[model samples]
Target: MAVKKKLAVLFIVDLIIIWFSIYSAYYFRFEGKLVEPYVNQMFLYCAISSVLCGACMAYFGMYRKMWQYASISEMFAMCQAVAIGWALSYAAASVLSEVRVPLAVAVRTLETSLLLVGGVRVIWRVIRLRQSSGMDKRIPTLIYGAGDCGALVAREFKGAAMADHKLIGFVDDARDKLHLTIHGLPVLGNRTDLSTLVEVFKIKEIIIAIPSVPRSQVSEIINLCMASGVQIKIIPAINDLIKGKISVNAIRNVDVEDLLGRDPVHADLQGIADYVHNKVVLVTGAGGSIGSELCRQVASFAPDKLLLLGHGENSIYTIEMELKHKYPGMLFEPIIADIQDRKRIEEVFDTYRPQVVFHAAAHKHVPLMEKNPAEAVKNNVFGTQNVADCADKYGTERFVLVSSDKAVNPTSVMGATKRIAEMYVQSLNASSRTRFASVRFGNVLGSRGSVIPAFKAQIARGGPVTVTDPQMVRYFMTIPEAVQLVIQAGAISQGGEIFILDMGEPVQILKLAEDLIRLSGYEPYIDIPIHFTGIREGEKLFEELLTAEEGATKTQHARIYIGKPEVIQQEDLYVELQKLNNVVLGNSEDLKDVIVQLVPLFARVS
Candidate 1:
């Protein structure tokens, strides 16, 4: 109703604008003397000019736009309408041999029309600004981090009732930026002054602006903001901040994923789309973080067939069922099979002949894999070889293995096994007819065993939230974003390329746990106990995405990087692999040695 009324009011104003434009144009062109001769007949000229002006405006589409989102297109249309209307008025007086108004009338009318239209728009917007000022004034928002995203958040509130969040200042990670102003919002101080800044500004909300900052840092800021009894909001990732494609609607609240401290990498969208579009694609571990996300994105590109393969009955069935419901026509198969078993994998591959494959199945728990290295080898190493070999044997076109940052300078058996698997896939690509690739990234935001869930569960249980070590930090990425990039890498891949998806920065685990505790409407370390547990065996202070010996060259995609490593002969690696396979259980003592030999950087923790 408000929208309709506003439009109706605008319609009457548009009519008045058209009349005034032509009348003023005549008055300015013909000085006082020209008007004196035809002064008595002026009322008739005015009436005719008004009718002509209305017609010109209608023809030029002057009333079709709304002022709020109205753009240059409408302004241009108004210019054209004024031109036509004023020109017609001058021509009628000259041609009809009646009241003669000079041509300058048209130019004056043009200027008047522009001012009237533009001024009214600015005035209307200003009126709305004043009306919303109280609400905007009520909530003084302090945005943390002074970057491009921070500047955008400040702009969002200044124009309209969008978020109604009044910009106060910025609280950043570096003290060097303390006195800097972004988009007119001052950078009050570094993160240390959060409590004081909140009180001083009477901040009602804190918006996080640094999308590139490690999740640990983001979490710490969120905790500080929350502790002051103020709400916290986080800007969306770079992809969501797409220029002009999206509006302030995308400037959203801080999510659980943000605290996980993960960032997105670039994926070769066209390459991935080409391979998956209209082709049969199968992903193992379908219900897990990576698999489910792969399914979600694959469905959008119109695949002819999709196979959700996983051992866990519930996970497979749920993801398969969900994808099927969303994409009704696509042929989706939910397969229950252990990737480690030769016969079962053989059966699935032969029956499906899936064109593209993403082997996501693995035993990724570090400490668990450390304790039971056998399971890690069987699942991560042997399972991967089985999938890749079968994909080659069955004439499947592409096979992309999902690897981890732990695989770089690995400390745990899980990382070692993954590294070994990467070697086999790379080695196999050299000789095999099928193209195989590996996507190595870091820990995902909300995977089955990620720290975010653990923290949330601990925080919910009340009291102690456990952290492995305050100093321990790891690179992270959002599962969905990582999965999209993984699929993209798979689509673009040809032959044996090892792509390391960029995981932005490392974040401390303790800060993450503390932030999660605070975001849940609690005071950190006081309302929630943070229990410090010593680092687990085979766990290190940090994980690496690239080994010291290896260097990376980024792909056309910003997030996807290719690692240059010396390629080994597939025949030689096969011989060593065969001996290890024969003594999978018998050589437990030498297993660690064999793994390090296979992956030179697969170091054990001190």
Candidate 2:
């Protein structure tokens, strides 16, 4: 109803403007000395022109636009509508009149009408902008990039009336752009001057708008911004911007992963698609972080069927629903059976007959597994055996076991079990037709039982984020990146190769804690105290990707490497595994010794 009333008012106003323009045109043409016939002609033309112009404007959707946000497009539409209306009016006047209207009069009328219509919208838009700017409580902010992305962000702030930010200026590293002005905001200085500018301008926020730059550079800028103690936000990446997903609201806080300084993983999309496309794929532990991501990536390739097998029904059901929602036509089976249950696992294998299998289910937590060595062996070792044997029996195409860097010179039962699983699968590849391989990498940033969640929880509670050891360091990768490389490893597998991902530089646990605290807007050991707890049982000071026995060799992908570990005899390993399985059932105190017998590098920590 309000919109209708607005349109009515616009129609009446436009009609009045049309009449005034025509009258002024005639008065100017005749020098305010119009004769009787001319006056009659003027009245006829004004009435006809008013109706024609109103119809033209309405048809052009002039009244539908919110004048407050009127722009060049609206002005262009006004010009077209006025020109068409004038032409139609002249035609009607020429056809119906005994006397012809002068071309000068028609031309002058059009000029006046277009000017009035277009000018009014521009003035209204300016008035609205001024009003909004006056009323808005905009925080004084600095944009860190003076490039195209920075310009767009500035425009968004100005054009979006609801935006609660006032851009102070821009800061760019490009020497040419150092002193230039962008969208009325000056490029005050480069990043080096960021801290000084923040103080000088009283900036409450710093928006990093260089989305195309490396994350390492962004992290450096973030660290500099942290010095100012101001709120920081970043624009979405170039791809997100190109997709039209970027907006003022799309800006988000810098996550910990952003500080990793890791380059974006560029996987061979065609290769992955070729491997998983139209194939029956099965992912164990589909509810866990890495496993769930594996399922999602595999499903993207239009697989004939995806089997999400996990011990936990809820996680399996959750991924299943998500996949169903994402790929409605794609088939998915959610199985809730523990991998340790050999009978159930074999039954699932026999039923699904999955061509490719991603064996990710295992006991991975270090401290917890140290206490429950037998359970870790049962799940990580025997459970893997069950799946491997089933895959072998069913003539599966490829079997990839998700191994860990902790498996190298393992200290904990968890690591030992993972090593045994890797060995067993590698040995099984010798006799089985299935291409068995293991993809080894280190800590996934936000996986279950990772330190990130624990640190975040401690920080959220407002105190003392505990670190196991100050000097402890471990390789970290994003779960998605790890999963992508894992799949790529499977696609390129010859069999029995342990593919290791190049997890960049190891991050110190203490520094990680400090950075997390800073990112959370708290000072390490000042606002939020960080306490160092001695390293837990079965924990290592540093993690290794390859042991002395397992020398590294490059693969087709630079980031992935093959570990050339000595091949153990499949028969001998099986005999030892059977003994270990029997010993686990009984309360054997020599479980660590038995693990050492299998994995000579296993260190017994009391």
Q: Which candidate is the best by TM-score?
A: 2
Return the lDDT, model 2, position 334: 92
Provide the clash count, candidate 2: 0
lDDT of each: 0.77, 0.89
**For model 2, what is the alpha-carbon lDDT of residue 556?**
82
lDDT of 1 at 200: 83
Off by over 4 Å in 2: 1-137, 243-245
True-structure RMSD, every candidate: 14.7, 10.9
Model 2's alpha-carbon lDDT is 0.89
Instruction: Give me the displacement of residue 324 in model 1, in angstroms.
Output: 1.7
lDDT of 2 by residue, 287-367 (tens): 999999999999999999999999988899899999999999999999999999999998999999999999999989999
The Cα RMSD of model 2 versus the native structure comes to 10.9
**lDDT string, candidate 1, 1-606, tens digits:** 777787678767866775677566555555545445555334445565577766787687655555655567877776777667767765675566554554565567667877886678767766776776654546787878777677776777677665455677887777677798778778888867888888887787787777666656676666566678777777666666667243566656666666554444445667767888888888987778888888888888888888889989999888878887888888888899999998999999999898998888888899988778878888888998888889999988899899988888788888889888989999988877888999999888888888888888887899699888889998877877888888878866877888988777677887777667767767787889888889898888888888866699877787788888666888788887877776676846677777766776767554
